[model samples]
Target chain A: MLQGNCEILKREQLTETIFDVTVSAPEMAAKAKAGQFAQIRAEGFFLRRPISICEIDKAAGTLRFVFEVRGGGTEALSRLAVGEKMDLIAPLGNGFTLLPQGEVIVIGGGIGVPPMLGVALSYHGRAKAILGFRSRSAVILESDFIRTGQMPVVCTDDGSYGKAGVVTNALVEQIALRRPDLIAACGPEPMLRAVIEVARKEGIPCEVSLEQRMACGVGACLVCACRTVKNGEEHLRHVCKDGPVFPAEEVLL
Target chain B: MNRLAVTVAGVTFRNPVITASGACGFGREYNHFYPLSRLGGISVKGMTLRPQEGNLPPRVAETPAGMLNSVGLQNPGVDAFLQDELPWLEKQDTRIIANVAGHTVEDCEEIARRIEGSAVDMIELNISCPNVKQGGAAFGTSCMAAAEVTAAVRRYTTKPLMVKLSPNVTSITEIARAVEAAGADAVSLINTLLGMRIDLRTRRPILRNNVGGLSGPAVFPIAVRMVWQVANAVKIPVVGMGGIATWQDAVEMMMAGASAVQVGAAAFSDPMAPVKIVDGLAEYCADQGIESISEIVGSVHPWE
Candidate 1:
């Protein structure tokens, strides 16, 4: 909802492909929520890259962004250093919903792990973080989850890390041990589909963050169309406006 | 004289900046960035007789300074626009031009007729949309077909009618003149040029539609040249678009004979693009000591 040339307060190359940076955008940080995203402008690119807010440091007046170098846009973005200014349209799309005084389980997959951090932190000490990565080196933000006043359960596909399977495996294991009030996630469509199915079977409320090719991130362009069902009928929703996040039942896929 | 306002087809705009069809939607989303009243006008999403779901993703793809979209005129039906969006747009203190697209002449006329009794200010006949299978760029690529649809819609509406021209045609000026002869009060060009992009890994077109209309800085020069040609070909006002991103692009477009200009894909980069162009025009006019921004229209003295 705000445009500012925020200065990069810190930057770290989490891995060769992933990046972690925090920007000084106080007003946007103040208005930001756990599941929202920021459309960061890369120099010379026509479309701004949509990066999910990994963490919101309201006291420090900064918001953390974590992303992988997917293509040209993110490749250009990954090259920026600390002290550089990046133009951003922040706190966009709907964020995950939180319940009052209830234990929650936050699940994330690969790059999808970032969006869940803010929600996990909000429920600090009472929240559980189960993350899945392609391998151990691809893993990120373990220490940050520890900052949430809890130890995280990390899983790698190669079994080079904590658990030897996907986050759904961790999710099912955790769900059976003790039921959490809610589950929230963001990741690949197939993975989200699996997570949604598991949540539905368990009768647990869930919200997921979706991604789409977008232009006019404000929803005026209608490029980022997401399909969902309402009242026994299918409807087209704007991922940029209606949500990057939606309830598990409302989403069609 | 007002510095930014310009008259098109006897209708005065508070500014020469309008958001092109398919760019600003119905002014509902961009309203969060800034007030819509600051714009001279907004051409809402292209509408049909019934609601359209538009093309499936990926509907847009980035290529250099521009982007391509095959949105395929997704919109709520005309009746829904009149009932749901028109009232909210009317309260915004900006001109509302309903952009109508149809598969046939009757379809376009029906939409125009429905807008006749509403608070809408004008009707922009969209014969240039490139994504649809029929009646979009098909009617626009031919002079006779463009004229036929223009004349049909003209008979149905008392509103000032503007025909939007497609750049995919052989001679754009011929289509512009044909629409003019068929009772078009004005002409807006150029709609996105037909373009395609493929991913090397997938070895398939990036957009779901395979091809889309390209807009942005990459197409600005073509738009300027076409606007100049069409502006001279027909006596009707020329509302130019395509890559009118920066304030400088607006000045260059106006100098090429556009009475007004529309900001298209550029607004996606920055929602305040048109508003910034409005302020930039004021600054440029003041510094140049020009009394009216309209004074610069077609003022480019080309070398002999």
Candidate 2:
């Protein structure tokens, strides 16, 4: 992993509480993979904040980050203007495992949609995205997902947008239409549990990206640990190092 | 003469900046940023007799100029360190100080015996971990308990022993003198001070353990004060640490009577923090026309 001040190439207010930033981080963008993250240092904050890599454009030497204003740290990050510099530790955490040639269904809920877009881009036309949100205003990255040559299946809980329920329903419908070889997802724990259940029952392999309050993003601090099982032995794993992404079978969540 | 070198407990460090234990885990994560040899030494993560799972989530929380961490001595056990971690770290061309922690004097002695012939350069007894339920800071808070654990482990190992003292104590000098009389080679102080942060919304504590050890720039003054007091109280060498981030902080710590210094929370804020301090110290030494960096140790002339 590399740590330095990467120039902010672009910054956009995606919604009332969400933001999108692209930075001129050649080395980092070149090394970044889907489901991985970057720890961006906000001015005056003790610990750097961890945000997932939403898009990695190697050609432009830039990485796009989409994050919600969760606290003082992220709020500070959202305020930086273009032409500014943001200190970052990049391409951290273990990313997703996508087969070279296979159909995959990517499930995303709310802010989790950004990371799925990176995974979906890897599959191009072969990946189907099931995006869910709280309402029309909360929905984001619809057009970005479409740019991957696939019309994303959007779902809203209040029926303010696409379908009238959660993404799990859309997932079941799409599964019956065409059985995907693999399932990739990122979202709240309940949604992940439901997605893992569907993948387990259908016998399709699944991988998930998890989130936790973290420090020393390189995994030395052991602050972002998750209880997981492997080969019948349970152990606490660092989400930042062991993975932000893991095979669904290994995660206790 | 080595400009930045300072000898502590018979071991000659290339510099005086060692990465504090628990802040840098086994020297693996930060190795990608810079070579481990850039540091004077490394105190690996705190270890116990058996693998410890640590505490629940939200183990860390930030505060004014500092952060509270209640990791509760989570480690892969001392055997794992000797078998798996030491071989890799010993090859890093830097001194490795294995930080040992446990719930009892017997526990400390048992781990000391296990690592009696290991590659580590020293034994840093971690008796000031405030996050654990027992035998952590509990052992360091009292002179009798501190002396008991220190003397027990000193009998089992021939390696240099440095006892880490907590700032939460009423009389840190007494504990420092106690460990010194018990045969400690040196002392490193002050470990994080016990602190708490309550959540305004839930009317609860932010950390799952409710309290954690506090460290960062906020604790620098307190650490310097304690280091000054302890250095005066004990005849052994002092390795000052706690909230030391910049080269200026290192200069102040040395002037306060620390033979060497360790960088802790500062490394978390900047991965290259320790390396940067090493570079800056050399520059400061040259600019000040000091022939040897050790000349600055205990140089502060207190007016009081």
Candidate 3:
């Protein structure tokens, strides 16, 4: 990983509380992968905020990060203007490993949809995407997912948008039609649990990206540990180093 | 060039900035960011006699100026550390201070015996872990219990021993003096202070364990105070830690009577923090025209 000052190239409000920020970080963007995250240092905050890489533009030497203003740290991050420099450590954590030449179904919920955009763009196979949001106004990166994946499905809980159901409902329907070789997902715990349940029932291989409140983006601190079973023995794995991404069967979700 | 080297006990470190235990796991993870040889020493994560699963999730919470963690000594045990982790760590060009924790006196002695002739340069007895319910804070909070544990481990090994002290105690110097009397070669002070945070919405504790150890800039002043008091009370060298983030912090810690300082929570904000302090100390030495970095140790003079 490398630490450098990233110049904010652009910032846009994706929704009421969510934002899309593009920063100039050639070294980090060059090595960044789909599921890996960057730790952004905010002024007045003691710890760096860990945000996953939403998109990587290698040619432009920039990276896009989508985050919600959930706490003081992100609120500080959201206040940064264009051309401002922010300290960052990037290309952290083990990212998703894409399999070649297979039908893959990608499921995402809320803030989780942004990282899937990177995976969709990089997968060298038939990739389909299912995005779930709270309402029509909460939907983000729909057009980007459409441009990158084969078939993009959008769903909302309140029937305010396309399909008017959860992402897992769409996942189950897609699994019935053409059984994807792999299922990849990222989102809140409840949504990830639902997706994992469906994948297990269908006997489809799956991978998941986990979110944890972290201190060190590096593996040094055991702040982001999650339970996982390896070879029948349960162990606590560091989400920052061992993975932000792990096989569905391996993780005890 | 000024002599940055410091000889604590029998082993000599190239510098005086070691990565605090529990912050830097087994030296493998942070090695990707910078070479391990650049550090003065590395205190590997707290190890135990048996593999521990640690505390339940939501193990960390961010406070105003620091973070609290309740990772209850999650480790692969001594055998695994010797077999799987130590081989890789032995190759690194730095001193290895193995931080060991236990629930009983035998557990402490057994682990000390196991690592006696191993790759580790010294054994740092972790009697100060506040997250665990047993053995840790129990032994560290009292002078008698702290001395007993230190003496027990001293009997099993010939290697230099450093007892890591807790900041939660009423009299830190009392425990420091007790450990020194029990044949401890050195002492490291101010392990995270016991603290808790509550989630107002849920009306419940933030950590699953309800209480955790707090560390970062918030605890730096406490660490300095404790280190100064312990340094004055003990004859053995004292290693200071707690919220040391910058090169200036390191210098201040040395003046407070610490032979060396460990960088802990600061590494979370900047992966290069420890290395930056190491280089920054050299620059400070050169600019101030100090012949040796050791000259600043315990140099603070208060106007009485």
TM-score of predicted chain B versus true chain B for each candidate: 0.99, 0.99, 0.99
Q: Show where candidate 3 strays beyond 4 Å.
A: A149-151
Q: Classify candidate 2 by CAPRI docking class.
A: medium
Per-residue lDDT for B1-304 in model 3, tens only? Answer: 4367887888889999999999998988789889999999999999999998899888999888899999999988999999999999889899999998988899999999999989889999999999888889999999999999999999999999999999898899999999999999999988999899999999999999999999999999999999999999999999999999999999999999999889988988888889999999988998998888889999999669
Candidate with better lDDT, 1 vs 3:
1
Best of the two (2, 3) by TM-score: 2
Cα lDDT computed for each candidate against the true fold: 0.91, 0.93, 0.91
Proportion of native contacts present in model 1: 0.77
Q: Candidates' TM-scores?
A: 0.98, 0.98, 0.97
lDDT, model 2: 0.93
Task: Give me the displacement of residue B262 in model 3, in angstroms.
Answer: 1.0
Question: What is the Cα-based lDDT of residue A229 in candidate 1?
Answer: 86
- Model 3 TM-score, all chains together: 0.97
* Ten contiguous residues with the weakest lDDT in model 1 chain B: B49-58
* Segments of candidate 1 deviating more than 4 angstroms: none
TM-score of chain B of 3: 0.99
**Positional deviation of A242 in candidate 1, in angstroms?**
1.1
Per-residue lDDT of candidate 2, residues B1-304 (tens digit): 7799889999999999999999899999999999999999999999999999898878889988889998888899999999999999989999999899988889899999999988889999988999888789999999999999999999999999999999898899999999999999999999999999998999889888898889999999999999999998899999999999999999999999999999999877899999999999999999999888999999999998
